[model samples]
Target: MEKFPRERIRNFCIIAHVDHGKTTLSDRLLQMTGTVAENKMKEQILDSMDLERERGITIKAHPVTMIYYFPEEKEHYQLNLIDTPGHVDFSYEVSRSLSACEGALLVIDATQGIQAQTVSNAFLAEKHRLVLIPVINKIDLPTANLTLVKKQLEDSLAIPADEAIATSAKEGIGIDQIFKAIIQKIPPPPSFPDQILRALIFDSVYDPYKGVILYVRMFSGKVKKGDKILLLSSNKTYEVKEVGVFCPKMVPEEALYEGNSGYIIANIKNTAEIKIGDTLTWETGGTTTALPGFQEISPMVFSGIYPLNSSEFEKLKNAIQKLQINDPAITISPESSVALGSGFRCGFLGLLHMEIVQQRLSREYGVDIITTYPSVIYKVSLRSGKTIEVDNPAKLPDPSYIDHIAEPYVKSYLIVPSENIGEVMQLISEKRGSCESTESLGHDKVIMHCYFPLNEILVDFNDKLKSITHGYGSMDYTPDEYRISDLVKLDILVNGEPIEALSCIVHSSKAESRGRSIIHKLKERIPRHLFKIALQAAVGGKILAREDIGAIGKNVTAKCYGGDITRKRKLLEKQKEGKKRMKTFGKVDIPQDAFLEILKTDTKQS
Candidate 1:
């Protein structure tokens, strides 16, 4: 194997929709570059995370560097590959991955043409000023249509689409051409002064065995093993204990200099010490240029997370704090949830991020948790003349004390086959989404862009869209401005006690129907307690929806059963003890499933 000169290094990421062969193409790239043995290759190998491989999705951004030799000119090039999440919910993670790349490999499913996510990600690449190298993948699929995709790329992106290569990444067909296209389209690393040692920390992860592995793309100077470095983002300094380039597996090299991309392991005791988007420079600061667009990430989705066992609450908090070090997009704060007890209010980019956090908690920390329904930030103006930000439902101001509210909106894109176009439009309209424009991409595929309230789809909208389209339509969205619309905040009460945290605002017309359905669902999932429970949904202190869950009967004929009636009574006592564990939402006894099941509901009137 040969290493390309540092000057030939090209740091880029492959962006695409799920199952669009982003991972497969990444594996083929590694093979073409001789980073991984052909026979030893696995599917989605770059998705090294156990959770990601099991889910058949790339949940985290994975970094790898390979040496590819263009056979035509016999020129060797070093490629730094960042494989990013394709799901729309992880778009923020994708943005962070994009920051590390000067170019992008936009993968389009040849059979599917351009899906919603692919076009959205390509636009994101353009926003980052990344040189886009379009690659049509899965050519071997029976429905593959390379010619139309070429035309779509040309018409939609207006990029030169003359020489689009078709590939079956799984079969390694046209893999070399894809590599050649990358080298031809993506520019070589820029020259920087050797006077200063500086690099950008694009991503970081905690490894119990390796400590903190920071993914870095070097811009100037040279970094050697055992060098003391300063993390500009946190002003923390550490000695680099190990350094290596990612070659499917870490391949330790002698050194990395300007224009090379690799990972460095500092002998830091805590993984939480490393922050993504941090800059690495010499401890003895000499010169520096602030990297562009290194803003701190703010989570967009918020929820309450409590341990299934109250005693583990503190442990969950500590675990979250540790995880937040590597996961900048996740935010945690102390919160008292009526339905979840005293837990942490966690914020994430989207639902996928929330799921990743929950999975990590159980798998990595061995902690089981009861999570509240995910919510987005709500801007509230109190009557006291102070503006407040609420991420948890419990923090919502009382309807009597509230002045006005605003919720975030998102610009969404829905791509569907022409046959399902009507169904897609109908679904969007039902979600209060306004069509922005529609474009026909030849064939039967159409791209529809709409402006939708974030609150409308934050729950259940994704599943409903998939269900309606019969899995043919896919969508991606980016946060837009907060919009003030006619809305009413509905509060949930259990046994005449208001659970402020379970409150949510819905458009007035849908409030009654939604409130009734949600309350009914909650009742079905929640177990009966010793006392009868009343579930009420209130707007402006007036109840719009109500339900009652009958209490468990205490009296059982002790002598009616077997000889061990004492044991049976003891078992009933245990059942009563379990009832005490059920969380209360106002007067309702909510079982564990009530929180998660709410996210899967669809209000399409089907």
Candidate 2:
């Protein structure tokens, strides 16, 4: 296939919610543009990750360059395709991908219309100054309503409704129109200076056999094989081993220059030497200024990740370090967990990001992890006029030790069909969420943006939301600010010792019920050991709930049966002979399962 001319080169990303036909549209575009043979095209062609394919959700941002031939002018245009993730947790990855594009194909499900994620994604694109081309996808469905979807986009986003393209990517209907719209509506990337070799590193991945592959967008200068470049973010230099442009199937070696797009690979000993948002310049005298947005991402979601087997701590650390080299968003630090043993305190952007990290650890690294309850970092002030940050529930200061505690909250946007608005409101209200405003998206759709306590929705919120909406409503939320609320730290004592696994925080109102449930569940799951176990939930020295393990008489009395009858009798006599081994209903050792059961209890009862 012949490469298109430079003037027609367009770099754009496809943004949409999960199952909004973003990938299907991409396949159609590639097919119509003659970039791939019709027979070779498959579902989610751009979601090259095995996990992404299995889950049918785009996680990593995938980039592909295609050639679209225009019949009207006998022209072949170069199209750099960027496929971005749809989950809110991966929004950081989406933001990085948006920076590399000049425009975006905003996809909307015709029947479903604008979703919560769709609005947030479009806002991100607009923030980055990317031209938005609204496309109503999945037009082949019987329930697809293009007119309604168009009006929603126009009224809500202030875009032209008539300009929207109705496309059925599965059947390849109106795909050509979308492609034509891309060339007409999405302008070519603005030309940059060719004097310097400055490229923005959007993302990087490690290929064991191929070393590290860096995804970059060059703003100026040219890159070729054997060129020595310096990574501005890391301050480490590398000798470029190979330069190649993406061809969908294989990365063919090609010379990419200014106003063009592609990725480059340089063999280096340490993959950590490269980072996202870094600038690549010639080692000797290529460029002096570094690219912007080089700050490392701070993790908002925190959790204790430990190996199920204590001996795997070293292996777990190495696996996490290696994963971080590719995933810069994941931050790791040494953590000593009382219940889970030695582990690492890892940070992530959100829930989905956390899930992806844990999944990758188990699947990619072949490590068994014992993950603790996910928690948000809390800022606490002490009476001594000092402040401390706490992530572990066990580290929570005693009531006397803490002056005040602040928790993080978020401004959440929820998009639901008009019929489900009532249900949506009720669910949010229960979470201490207050409605900020409500606006209609055309007729049958309403967008509700509200302020909600982050902790309220941190657990099982996604599942509960889907169930309430009948899988129709979608949500997107961003951390807003820390707010002071009436919060109490609840502790669970096992045999008079507080185990980290049973520590939790509950609103003062629900403390009794939540604490009771946690104690009951822990008692049921924890196996009986030699000693009786005492499960107690307390708040500020006040016991709220209690449960106990049954004791054995014969097993306890065996110690007195043998051993110099007189000495054994003398030893037992001090405790009234067999009375020391008498059957006590509340005596049994707490097993590992006891701690794990605490996580499964209903700790959010109100």
Per-model TM-score, in order, reads 0.87, 0.91
Over 1-606, each residue of candidate 1 has an lDDT whose tens digit, in order, gives 244565577888999989898988888788777788878877778887788888889887888877777778877788888899999877777888887788898998998788889889988999889998888888898989888889999877787777567788888898877777778778877776554887888787777787778888887787778888888767888888887888767878766777777888887767557666777899885345556756566788887788888889889987888788667678777877656678888888888888889999999998888776567887888788887887766666667888888889999888877888787778788888899899887777788889998877877678887888788788898889987767777676777677654566677878788778777777888898676788887787689889988876765554456676678778777766656664342244466566657544423332
TM-score of 1: 0.87
Query: Largest TM-score belongs to which candidate?
Result: 2
Candidate 2, residue 276: lDDT:
75
Error of 2 at 285 (Å): 3.4
- Put down candidate 2 lDDT per residue, 330-351, tens digits, no spaces: 8788888666788888888887
Task: Give me the runs in candidate 1 sitting further than 4 Å from their true place.
Answer: 1-4, 270-273, 318-322, 522-534, 548-606
Indicate the residue-level lDDT of 8 in model 2: 83
